[model samples]
Target: MVPTMMLVADSSRDAHRREALCDLADAVARRGEAPVVSSFGTSDELESAVASVDGPLVVVPAFLAGSDRVSAELLAGLDLDQRFDACATPPLGAVPSIVGSLARRLGQAGWRPGDGVVLAADGAFDQDERQQLTSVARMLSRRVQSPVQVGYLDAWAPSVGDAVERLRRRGQRRVCVASWQLVDGAGHERLRELDATAVTAPLWPAGVVVDTLLSQHRAATARLAA
Candidate 1:
């Protein structure tokens, strides 16, 4: 039997931010028939939700970086015996399809072929997670056939202001910021302070995101079935 997917996210206290996540998950679940679940302040809640779900479970993390405690807890608490099939898909930002989504959004925001682009991500505390952001920036760079700089909001170096300044120093008059964030909240508020040509919206509500989530779910299911 095909396992049903359960998307797990780190809970946010911001009501609007939390609602946006739920809405995005609901949109994706509708396309893939997966149920959405979030880790609210503890791993116990996530584990309980997983236990309550019937049939084989396919867990998908609704985060951009994988080294966080929430991702760790979801992976650690799982017992992949006969019931739970797969867990630990790559984070949403690292997914390749997201590059296209970002590219289109940037273009819509007046990004030209010669304009510089900054891949702006909500900073991660983990070094590995920060490295993943760099990797995503590189991938996006290749996709658009233009140079892309990696910028963080906090907890890391080369902040949004710094990236934009660097791009300006490099003679770029228009620098587009591709938000590597999933939803708008305090993290995004920092991006507004950056003096960029234009800043694209977060990844939420994008069709490509839904496709990427489904692809991750399918790959996990295939791995378990094999």
Candidate 2:
């Protein structure tokens, strides 16, 4: 039997975040794939779905980075009836196409030649996740032909507002925040609250997001088949 595709995300009360996940699941389903969306906080629902599935499961972490921890935590949080064949794909942030998506959002936000760019992320406490975000900023810098600074929304130094202010102090007339979130939420709202000249939308509804998820799902499916 074909493995069910489960897209799991961190718990969030933001309505936009929930809607975006549903939209992503719908998009995947429209492609003739069986996709299910769940969150870590909803353990009962998640366990119910897992129990209902008959075959192997391809678990896709619906996060930009640090998905391995998310996946591990999710499994640990739930008490399943039995052990089932399951595999998780890489996080969305690890996909190379994400850099292009970020660059596109910057262009859409009216970024100019001398505009200072700050890649704003929902801070990760894990050192490896922090490094991954920094790498994303560097990749974005190269893609946009500008130096990109990394900033965190929480639990890290150099907040988004601070990054923007530093650029302002350096004589930059416009400072654009390239949101590094997968969906709009408290973090995106915090970014907009910052004093930056412009804040780009989160990387959702972008073709790359769906494409990357599908690519990961297909790869996991192939691995399971083997």
lDDT string, candidate 1, 1-226, tens digits: 7676776766645667667777877787677455555443346667787778776667777666722344444555666565544455656656677777877888887888989898887666466676777788888888889899887776567887898899999999999898877766656666766788998877777788778878888888788778
Every model's TM-score = 0.83, 0.87
The TM-score of candidate 1 is 0.83
- Report the lDDT of model 1 for residue 69: 41
Per-residue alpha-carbon lDDT of candidate 2 for residues 1-226, written as tens digits (9 for 90 to 100): 6678887775545676678777777887787765555553465667776677677887777777732344335544655335547776656674569889888899898888778999887676466677788788888888888889888776676988898888888888899999888777666777888888889988887878888888888888898788
How many pairs collide in each candidate, listed in order? 0, 0
Q: Write down the lDDT of every candidate, Cα atoms only.
A: 0.72, 0.75
Best by TM-score: 2
How many clashes (backbone atoms < 3 Å, residues ≥3 apart in a chain or on different chains) does model 2 have? Answer: 0
